[model samples]
Target chain A: MEINGKKYKAVVIGGSAGSFSVVSKILSKMSPDFPLPVIVCMHRLKHVRSGLVEGLNLKSKIKVVEPCDKDKIEGNKVYLAPSNYHLFIEFDNTFSLSTESVHNHSRPAIDYTFSSAAYTYRDKVLGIILTGANKDGANGLKDIHDKNGTTIVQDPASCDIDTMTKAALNLFEPDYILTPEKIAEYLNQLAS
Target chain B: MARFISKTVPTLSSFERGLGLGLKDVRELSAFMSDVLGIPYDHMPVSFFKRRLTNVFAKNNIRNVEHFKELLTSGDIKENIYHDFSVSITEMFRDPGFWRYLRSLLQNLSPGKTFTVWFPDASSGEEVFSFLILIAELNMLDRIKVICQHPSSRITEDIRKGILRNKNAEVNANNYIRIEGNGNFKDYYSLQDNIFVLNTYLLQNVETVTGHFLNTAINEPAGLIMFRNKMIYYDKEVSEKGIKTLTGKLSPGGLIAIGGKEKMPESTMSSFKCINEKERVFKKHGFDISWNNGN
Candidate 1:
């Protein structure tokens, strides 16, 4: 069960602007039998909820979906944060969506999800910060670090929009800073 | 060595806010709230309850759980205390497509047949106001009655007053426009001192009910029950109870509209056929989709 020398319960990735293609590429590289559930929190237009999942599904070896409230987290699947709702991984490991006030100007705020994942999984969570234009996910990723969870930020030099990852980098030291390909490779290695 | 090098590049290294409440505090608050308010704060997801607890503490400027507990047990502001912990964030025409489908459903109602729409928990006024405007637009105001319920009297009063101001009026108008709304959206409301107050005619049919309407049986079964997004705040048993209550309140062939992101309990979901999966609109077994086909 050791991934990168430690077993992890869940993998959470957060991104905003310019993250779609990178996420799609990363998901495309994942093996169909990827052993850990991938939970993604990406900022998106609230009303237009369809295309993102469909696009990810097309590129992913595993299914991509906007999870309904109380949906169980399962391996080899990607759960996209639904539009306008902040997604949380409850203590029971089920997904719950909230219309809570925006944090860092994002409703599906990465901080809420990453914070929940860290709190639920503790040291067994792996959090990744990807390219984005806002500071939403920085505090959440820091929560993971504080809990001894593994944290990674996509290298800002490679990010199309570096604000998000750089913000996270400024908050706390992540385990590694990687490119999209390297992030995918890291995930694939974890699955193996 | 590569791994060692990554550690040297620390930048700001300044950690800000953290998720504060622990599981023990969460359980304590839930138990206290259940004992004091008789509401199932425990039945809510732990993370949600934790956040709600943190919110309550911060909102009231309480030093800690002990402080919050003292204020509640003191009973001077018991009603306000209960109201503060409840969460309901909604916007007018939230999921604008849902409103569009609703208009289509109302278009098919048989002439002279009265339809009752129930908002089992209209914690926020936006959804209720949106429905009222839709009903009024269809010119079916006389035949339709809405039973609106909320734990907060303040919210109910806002709905009763037709106050749309400070409630994202501009965003709501944009959503209305997104749905290809007919005529001027402004025609439905007025600007008094730069506040958008909905026309009074729309409020005439709204009936505000207090107490736990979920457990109480309505004399008239509702044609449509909108229990949207509210149950995401709850855990399994309470949400199921809510679904059962919604089903019981609906007429034999009536429909249930839940939040687009919510899932009905497995047993209940299988029993009610999905009418609009995208919008999370489901119908009781007796309902026929062909009725609204407009063919």
Candidate 2:
């Protein structure tokens, strides 16, 4: 699946439950010089804050770090939403973290990141919804699609837990629906 | 190219207006709050006020701003509205790295001199309790003095007694482990009828005051002032005023820590030097250099 020569500024990936390994696989296969900022918004245990980023860093070619509040968004890096904070992509292309009440029973809610990125980046965004047990990313993926941004959902049959992908498919028609391996191939092709 | 977005989104204003809440309506409401509750709601960020008002309206089942205004003018729901507006969400040892940096800074302070710290917004006492635990762990409880201030007397009283809601236990315990490396967090508190009560012994150096830091006159200077995450609720002008008030209370060379997301207004930058820019830690200038460097 080619992007048809459209230049994208940012890529936002939202997942939950079984998405960690899928995200790790994508990141490990991504080239070191990949030129777009990748934002990962995953539902993580609020109590266990230390291990996810470190675990991702060990296998990923690109740098992965949990963003502090107001950290500038930059290319060739993977920014993970920190636990217990709802991460919003501000118009300035920097992150603003909020400790406001949780949404969809999750802080670091995928909807917040995806909607904000869609609003801020508009048609320049590429949003990908991966494996998860809940419907957290459905509205967000729809928002991206509504804003003329490219939206992708991992095929429900390919996901370990298909609830999230099925939810997205039920909500709106995404630009692409493929397995994790195909998703990585598309991302690599986009980079080139 | 990054451009500044207006702090108050247009959609919120139109939505409020559709509900019969125009600028004049908000102004009148702000005036009523100031006169009745002593809170300067006029100075709050419009977006923040709108969000809170939406919650207030939904919770109270108020039909519109006009109905809410009538209820406010009646004077029966002042306390309820105040309580709803003042409910702060905070966690213990928020940003573990900031706490670790604070620990090192406290250790570097001049030995044998009493250290003074202030919590201008001690909402629910998580931060105050977290600091007390740190001081106790360092065995410097005797050498430290803490003053906690909140707008509600009830909250102040609860904090003075070291009472905290149990909902934050898991996050607090996780942060404590990150800070301490290894230990049972239960050693510091006892469960009393489902609430976590800090050991009163650790409260020796802490005092709670019922007042608004923005309006209260504080004569004492503090070595460290914690006013984190509260500024985001205020408009630019009020945020500037609050920053000035807090900075005025700092002793020379003392440090002030703000929320990581907050930025020091350019107007106030000359008075304090950045210590940890990412953590929003700043130290007031004009103290003898040797005092910090240890000559």
Candidate 3:
């Protein structure tokens, strides 16, 4: 969407156990010129520091970093939430860090980011739930669908850890359910 | 206005620089004096405060105005500064006729199906709860949705978290029940000791959303948009833009409301058909209007 002479597209991704490989597979297929701010949240122990930033950086073509409070969302940036806090998008399209507890036992919860982005961005939002071990991103993907935004989930059979993806696919009819390569291809097409 | 001739003169820039005062401090002081005295500090500057400063400098035998900078840096003069600068502008329900007309308008609109009203500038939460009271009194609370601006999300983190403290809950609820009708507005909050935290269910039902009107349009077209007494600080250009945005966001048959003293400027006034000129309500023309950027 064009807002105030600037174009915007928001992609939000959430995953668990097999997120690193899925992220790498997707990013490897994306073209160099792909534009859009992508926010990713991966469920890990609240106390244990996540290697998500480092892990994803090795796999992605785009710049990846952990987002700080009020950091403006910019095209081509990949922002990951910290392990313990629920990340939300402020009305201004900037990331806000909240310790407002958890949903479904995940601190950097997928639902929080997905719901907040969907609410803030409206129809321009895209939500993706990938390989995980729990039903964390199911309600979130559904929330995105409810808001007239796009929702995507990795194919359950193709997912290494199928519980999260299987749960999401069964509960909500996501707009697209595909393998990692296909999901990557679709992302590249949109980003281009 | 007579220009002051200092006994021991210094150039304006030198005087300011010597005093170690930044432009922001001076601007704040100007605003404070203007607000307290109900005068335009820039156009019709206050001479008395300037003269007082001059006298203070002269009495101290300070060669340059900079020498008295200790006052601002230290405590003695800060208290005096605040004492003279505080503003007490608004009175309770300052405009009686507006309230009366609004009450009557609510009674008239009572027969409609789901008459939603939006108050976009609810600074102290009074207007949102006030509308809630009116709608609840009409037994139409279930039918109506009052979309209020979420105050916390816009500003800093501390300000966001610290807003709407528990102390005002009792009074706010009492005002709602007493003014409109008796129903426990208190039930909408959880009181632990003196801390009354608002129940999310009440907030959710009332439908408050965090949004920036400058950057985003209202999610759903509103039946009525009321932004009153909030834009007085804005100049004509800004005011016209606000009016245009509100008009564009209103539903086809919906109404637009503003403060009694506020007006749609001539440049963009044609977009609206005045419903009640004195009451500051207008009907949207429902024509294609440009979202032309407003500075």
Candidate 4:
């Protein structure tokens, strides 16, 4: 598989339910000096803010930190959307957090981040839909694909809960379908 | 090897018909809102403007964009539309780190010197109450004065009466615990008929006024001025003008706090020094004569 020699500006990953471990595995294998900024949007308990970032940071070579509203985007860092805030990628490539009512029964809805990134970055974005129990990210991944951005989905068979990946597959054919290990390897190749 | 698929992806249009309005209809509605309602809908983000218009349409049972425009121009629905235009999402100690930073800044002030803090857009009294709680906790309530201004007279009246929304009690308590590290959250407010009424004693040094921050002139300088989150709603020009006006209200060596998500306009950046960049805290530069004179 090849990326068609296209350099991407940013990578957005969306997940829920069983995605944390997969995300940890992928981050653990990433180079500390990865060039593109990575944004992770996942479902979590709104009232709890401490554990997710810490857990991901423990194994990841690159710095993984929860970003505050208006934090500037920088290379080589992984930003986890804070719990209970809908994170949007601004036109200036910075983040804006909104406390507006929840969508898809989630505050930090996957669709909000994916759509905002697609709108701002357009074809420069690489969107990945990982394991989850719902169809929240399906339309967003489709939006990325429609905007000429690269789209990847974890193979349904490999996902602990295949509902999310299947939803994406049902909506539109993605550019790549791979297991978690292969996805990490593909990302590392891009870094190289 | 990761499986790569080569499929002819049919182009999908992600654009949804906004409120079922044609471009001409949207333009007409925008004009009505600006000319008749004085909202300047053209400056609002398209998505937000559409959402609000759709909400008003649904709530008022207007048939279409034309009807909506007709109702807006009639002057009878102006108040209803205006009521829905305001965004009021206030939280107690919205950002704990910001409050902590403010605490540190306040600590450096000269002991026993009285200072005034201004909240130009005190929406629902959550932030004003939070500051009062912080001052009370610091045992400096007598040394600090608060002036809260809002556009709505009803909200100002409620704020003056020390009434807060009961729904925020849990989050308020959690934030208080995080800030103070220990406390019975109920100590700050008494519950009456499911609403939390702040203790009137905490309101001793606070005054509530009813007026738009932009129209109201501050005759005296404020040690600290907070106009957070409200800037995001304003258009670029309005926000720039607001920053200038707020900067003019700051005392020499005073500080301005904005929403963490907001950025200081580039034109005004030279006038203030960024103290805590991430927290969006800026300080106006000037010599403090009292400190310089060793008071």
| Candidate number with greatest DockQ | 1
Task: Tell me the tens digit of each residue's lDDT in model 2 across B1-295.
Answer: 1111223212112222234454566667777667766777877644345446776787788897678778887976665576567645657888888788778777776777786789987777788888888888778899889999887776888899988864778878888877863346899889999998999999998888777888784668887889887776665677788889988888888788897667777789898888887678888886732135211
Interface RMSD, candidates in the order listed: 4.5, 12.4, 31.1, 5.1
Model 3 Cα shift for residue A63 (angstroms):
0.4
lDDT of 4: 0.77
Superposed model 4: Cα runs more than 4 Å off: A1-11, A17-21, A24-39, A43-85, A90-96, A102-107, A118-126, A132-139, A142-151, A160-177, A184-192, B1-63, B77-82, B181-183, B234-237, B287-295
* RMSD of model 2 against the true structure: 7.3
DockQ of 3: 0.01
Global CA lDDT computed for model 3: 0.59
Query: Could you tell me how far off, in angstroms, the CA of residue B36 lies in candidate 1 after the best superposition?
Result: 1.4
lDDT digits (tens) for residues A71-126 of candidate 3: 57888888888755667775556665544335686777887677667656767778
User: What is the DockQ (computed on Cα atoms) for candidate 4?
Assistant: 0.25
Model 4 residue B244 CA deviation (Å) reads 1.3
Q: Each candidate's fnat, in order? A: 0.38, 0.05, 0.00, 0.19
Write the number of the candidate with greater lDDT, choosing between 1 and 2: 1
Q: List the residue pairs that clash in candidate 3.
A: A36-A76, B18-B66
Q: Judged by DockQ relative to the true structure, which candidate is superior, 1 or 4?
A: 1
TM-scores for all candidates: the values are 0.93, 0.74, 0.40, 0.75
lDDT (tens digit, per residue) of candidate 1 on B1-295 = 0121333334332212323556776787788887886677778888777777666666777786677788888975466655566665546888999899989888887777787889887776778888887887788899888888776677666677877545577778898897777768888888888876889988898888754565455677888888889889898788988898788777777888999999888867755878788888888877522336321
Scanning candidate 4 chain B in windows of ten residues, the lowest lDDT window is B286-295
Count clashes in each candidate, considering only residues at least 3 apart in sequence or on different chains: 0, 0, 2, 0
Ordered list by lDDT, greatest first: 1, 2, 4, 3
Across A1-192, the per-residue lDDT of candidate 4 in tens digits comes to: 125677688999999999999999999988777888999999998756569999999999989988765568988999998876777776656776766556687878898788778876779899999999998888888888878999999988889999888888877888899888888887887787
Docking class of 2: incorrect
